[model samples]
Target: QWDKPLTSKVTSYLEDAKEFVPFKLKEVESAELINKNNIKTVEWVEAASDEEEALPDTSHRQEVTITFIDNSMLSGTLVSDTPRELSRLSDCLNTKESFIHITNGERHIHVNKNMLLRVTGS
Candidate 1:
């Protein structure tokens, strides 16, 4: 499992490509490396390097609840290499990015940054 080495790309809001889908290097580069099309936003998900391990490390992940502009809520994990405070998190959100990737184990969800109201960690 996870031996083929693949990346996931969501083509539309309702359509999602499987993480194990085989894609040509050019397609991966075009969709992931460079946003040439400008129509789709690609997020890369790397396979867990340690295949023998049953659980992946969660030390660098933060449990977060994201509130949207419409008052909707989403709970997921925010992966960060270094420790982060609320102030730092707020600053990053102020940059007006296009999407925020919320990962949950082997899956992830991309939320439009413009639609987010705030992110709270626990």
Candidate 2:
């Protein structure tokens, strides 16, 4: 991570890199962000009533739940003031994109928006 803002561009990690792994959202079935214990099962809540305004913002990292089109959900933490392009679930939920990038600690995941259902935070 650089000191300045990092946009959600297809990066090869090297500035002068000629080729990078193209992200084909349509072809991707599922992806996972490497975690400490590699736990993939996240408890799916049928209905979460925690309002965004009701949640305290004192904590830099807020708990978030991302529900996909298949009804499967992933519970993770997100930075309070994340960038716009990467802040779909935080800054503004109105802007729907083709993917949802989530950062949980050192883990980073990009969930295809076509398959994304809802993003709930608390």
Candidate 3:
């Protein structure tokens, strides 16, 4: 870890690096043991794309209630480029990616599928 610390999301660890590939190298498991994680979820307070919001008809947003594996629950909105892009709530959960994007106003919360028990009502 750098002496000068900075917060990062799932990716974007090296803020200044030009060519950054997440998990490009094989890291030792012991490194994680040294780093105690208090991270429950990775939530980003950021702006949504200008174009997406500008075209209201083209934008697809869905509200969902998630129950985590730990039995904690939350409600969030999922926004996508188009409904066909991710047609249904089930499709979002079944996507190849491990993380699903849920928006809370300007905030984007990427929840890991591994931590989910059941996700409903989107």
Clash counts for all predictions: 0, 0, 0
- lDDT for each residue of candidate 2 in 54-79, tens digit (9 for 90 to 100): 22344245577888777898777644
Span of 10 residues, lowest total lDDT, candidate 3: 30-39
Rank order (by TM-score, best first): 3, 1, 2
Model 3 RMSD in angstroms: 9.2
Give lDDT: candidate 1, residue 29.
55
What TM-score against the true fold does each predicted structure earn?
0.44, 0.40, 0.55
Candidate number achieving the greatest lDDT relative to the actual structure: 3
- For each candidate, the alpha-carbon lDDT, in order, equals 0.51, 0.45, 0.57
Stronger candidate by lDDT (1 vs 3): 3
Error of 2 at 88 (Å): 9.6
Q: Candidate 1, residues 1-122: lDDT per residue as tens digits?
A: 33432322232321333223333475455433332223222344545762443223532566789887778888887643333453355544554335555676666566666666788988
How far off is residue 22 in model 3, in Å? 9.3
What C-alpha RMSD separates each model from the true structure? 9.3, 12.6, 9.2
| Ten-residue stretch with the least lDDT total in model 1 | 5-14
- How many backbone collisions does model 2 have? 0
Off by over 4 Å in 3: 1-40, 47-59, 80-86
What tens digits encode model 3's per-residue C-alpha lDDT throughout 1-122? 44321222332332223332333226654322211122336675654443243324554677988898889987888645445766677775675554566777666676766778888863
Clash count for candidate 3 is: 0
